[model samples]
Target: MPSSTQVQLVRRPRGWPTEEDFRTVSVELGDLAPGQVRVRNEFLSVDPYMRGRMNDGPSYAPPYALGETMTGAAVGRVEESTSDELPVGALVLHGLGWRDVTQADASAFRRVEEIPGGPSSLHLGLFGMPGLTAYAGLTAVAGLREGERVFVSGAAGAVGTAAGQIARLLGARTVIGSAGSAEKVALLTSRYGYDVALNYKEAPIREQLRAAAPEGIDVFFDNVGGDHLEAALDVLNPNGRAAVCGSISAYNDSAPKPGPDNLSRIVTRTLTLRGFLVGQHPDLADEYREAVTRWFAAGELAYDETVVDGVENAVTAFLSMLRGGNTGKMVVRV
Candidate 1:
C-alpha cells in the first residue's frame, strides 16, 4: 500500500482562514479496484470560490466536510490504473485537489491533451475553469460589443487577466483594469492587454474609473465587489452590462457588509447587473477552450501563474491569494 499526504479542513473559518484550521495527514491507500485510478498531482488550484466552501453556509457548492481532505481542481498523471480508458502515465485533470496523491473512480478524471510548448498546469488557469468563466461572462452575461469600453476589478488575477485580454481581442476600444498594488497595475496594462490600469489603493476607485474611461464604460467585469461594484455603477454608460463573476472583497467578512449604495443607478441607467457561477454555464466550454487556445497559440493572449511548491504550502498559498498576494492564478505544485 502506498501512503499519501493530504490536507484536511479541521475547522470552519470565522473570517480569514488560519494555519490551525487545516491539518496535514498521511494515509495508507488500499489496492486499486477495477475502474479506479491513482494520480500523482502535479498542480492544484487555489481559487476565491474555495473560500465560500470553507464556511458552514449555503453556497453554490457544498461546504467542505470537517476533517476530510479539501477538494478543488488539480492536474496530475495517472500513476496506477485499473481501467483501459485511463492508462498509466496519462495526464489528467480532476477535482481531487489539496493532496499529493489521489485515488478515485476512473470516471472522475478527464484526460488532458498536451498543449505544444505549454505546461499542463495551464489546464488549471488559462485553458480551464477560470478561462471559461471569463469567456462566458463577457460573451453571454455582459453582452460585450465591438468598440465598447470595458472595466475589470481584480484585474491582475486569473479570470480578470483573461477577461481584460479577451475584451481587447474581441474588439473593445478601451479596456481598463483595477488592481491592489502598483506592480499589478503595471502588469495589467503592460502584460495583460489593458489599455488603462489603476491601483485602487492609490485613490478613490470612482475617481480613477471615471478618469480611465472618461466616456463611461459599456461593460464591467466585476471580480471584486463592494466599492468596485459601486464605482462601476457610477460610471457605467446607459444600458451598460456588468458580469458579476465574484465578490471576493466580502469573502472574508465576518459580518454582513452594506450593498452598493449606488445600485439605484441600475434602475435609472437601465443597466444590467447579473451574478453567475461558472458551473452554471458548461454549455460554453467547448467554444471557450477553442477560442482561448487559438488566441494563446497566436500570441494574442497571455497568462501568469504564481506557484507555491509543495502540498504543505497549499493552505498558505490559498490564504495569500485571498489577500491579493498573487498577480495571476495561484496554484500549488505538489
Candidate 2:
C-alpha cells in the first residue's frame, strides 16, 4: 500500500472559498491492480474554472463531489506501473490533481515527453490547457486574421498571457490587454508581446480601451466578463469577433449581477461573440502543441508561473488564483 496526501472538498462555498471548505488528509492506497499505475505528482494546476465546479451548478464540467479527493490537471512521473504502455519513469498528464500522489489505471494517464530541464509544471500551464484555450479561441472561434487588432482581458493571467503572445504571433497588427495592476500591465508589454497594456484599476476599463485603440478593436479575447465584456463591446469594430472564455469577475458573486450594459453593441457593430470551452476544440490540440512547442523552443514565447509550494497549500493557491493573486498560471509544487 502507498500513502498519499490529498485535499478534499468539505463543503460548497457560498462565495469565496475558505480553508474550512477543504480538508487535507493522508490516505493509504491499495496495490495497483493489473494495468494500473501509481504516480508521484510534481505539480498540480489551480485554474479559474475549478471555482465553478466547487458549487453545485450547471457547467461544462461536473461539480466537485462533497467528500471526494478534488481533481484537476496534474503532471507527474510514473513511479510504479503494471502496464507496459506507461513504464516506470515515464512522464504523464492526468486529471487526478489535488494530491501529491495519484494512482489509477494506465488508461487514465497520457504519457508526455520531457523537454530537457523544463519544469514538469509546464504541462499544467502555458504548454497545456491555458495555451490551447488561447490558440483555439483566437484561431477557431474568433477567426483572428492577419493584421487584425486584438484585445484580451485579464491579460496577465495564464490564458491572457498566452493569448497576447499567440495573437501577435498570428500577425495581429496590434495587441492590447487589460490587467489588474500597473506591474502586470508593464509585464504584458515587456514580455508578452502586447503593444498596449491598460491598468484597469487606474481608470475605467471602457475609457482606457477607447483611448488606447481610438479606431476600434477587431478581435476580443474575453476572460473577465462584467465591465471588461462591456468595454470590449463598446470598442469593437463592425464585423468584430470575440471569444468568451470566462467570467471570473462574477465567479464569487453571491447572486448573478446584471450583464454587460452594452450588449446591444453586438447588433450595432455586427459583432460575433462566441462562448467556448477548450475541450470543445480538441481537434486543435496537435496543432497548438506543435506551434507552441516550436515557439517556446525558439524563445518566441515567454510566460510566468506563480508556484505555491506544498500540496497542503493547494487551497490557498486556488483561492489566491481566483482573487487575481497569480500573475500567470497558479500551480502547487508538491
Candidate 3:
C-alpha cells in the first residue's frame, strides 16, 4: 500500500476561493485491481474550469463533492500495473485531479506516446483540451476565414495565447488581443504575433479593444464576457462571428449582474454568437495537434506555462489566474 496526499473541498466558497477552502490529507491506497494501474502524480493542472467545480450547483461539468478529492487533469508516471495493456513506468494522462498519487482503471488513463521530450505539461495545454478548444472555437464556431481580422479577449491565457497564433496560421490578416497586464500585453504582441495588444487593466477595456480593431472585428474570440463581450459586440462588423469560449468575468459573482449592455447590437450587426465547450469538438483534437506541432517544430509558434509548484498552492494558482496573475497556461507541479 502507498500513502497519497489529496486535496478535498472543505466548503463551498462564497465568492473567491481561499486556502481555507481546501483541506489536504494523506490517504492510504490499497492494491491495484486486475484492470488497474498505480501512478505517482507528477504534474497537476489548475485551470479556470476547476473554480466552477468547487461550487455546489449544476454546471456544464459536474461539481466536486465536499469530501472527495478535488477533480482535475493530471499527468503521472505509472509505478505499478496489474493490467496487461499498461506497462510499468509508462507516463499517462488522466483526470485524477489534486492528488499526489492516484490509482486508476487502465481504461481511464491515456498513454502520452506521441509528445516527446520533457515538460509533458504541454500535454495539458497546447496538445490537450485547451489547444483543441482554441482550434474548434476559431475555425468551427467563429467561422474564421483567410484575410479576416480577429480579436481575442483574455488573449494571454492558455486558450487565448493559442487562439491568436492559430488565427495567424489560418491566414488572418490582423490578430488583436486584450490582456490584463502590461507584461501579458507585450507577450501577446511580441511573442504570440498578435498585431495589436492592449492592457485592459490600465484603461477602459472597450476603448483599448476599439483602438486595436479600428476597422471593426470580423471574428471575436471572447473569453472574458461581460464588458469585453459588449465591447466586442459594439465593434462587430455586419455578419461577423463571435465564439463565446468563457465568461470568467461573471464567474465570481454570486448573482448574475447586468452583462454586455450591447445585446441590441447583436441584432443590428447581425452577429452570430455561439457558446462552445472543447469536449463538444473532440474530433478537432487531432487536427489541432497536427497543425500546432508543425508550427512549433518550424519555429512559427510558441507557448508559455505558468507553473505553481506543490498541490498546496493550487487554490492560490487558480485565484491568481482568475485575477490575471498568469501569462499563459497555469499548471501545478505536485
TM-score for each of the candidates:
0.99, 0.99, 0.97
Cα deviation of 112, candidate 2, in Å: 0.3
For candidate 1, lDDT tens digit of each residue in 151-213?
999999999999999999999999999999989988998999998999999999988897777
**Cα lDDT of all candidates, in order?**
0.93, 0.94, 0.87
Q: Summarize candidate 3's per-residue lDDT along 189-287 as a digit string, tens digits.
A: 889989998888898888877877779989999889988888888889999999999989877888779766778988998889999898899788778
lDDT winner, 2 or 3: 2
Clashing pairs in 3: 72-97
lDDT of 2 by residue, 129-243 (tens): 9999999999999999999999999999999999999999999999999999888989999999999999999999989999999889999999999999999898899999999
Any idea what lDDT model 3 has? 0.87
Q: For model 3, where is the 10-residue window of minimal lDDT?
A: 111-120
Span of ten consecutive residues with least summed lDDT in model 1: 206-215
Clashing pairs in 1: none
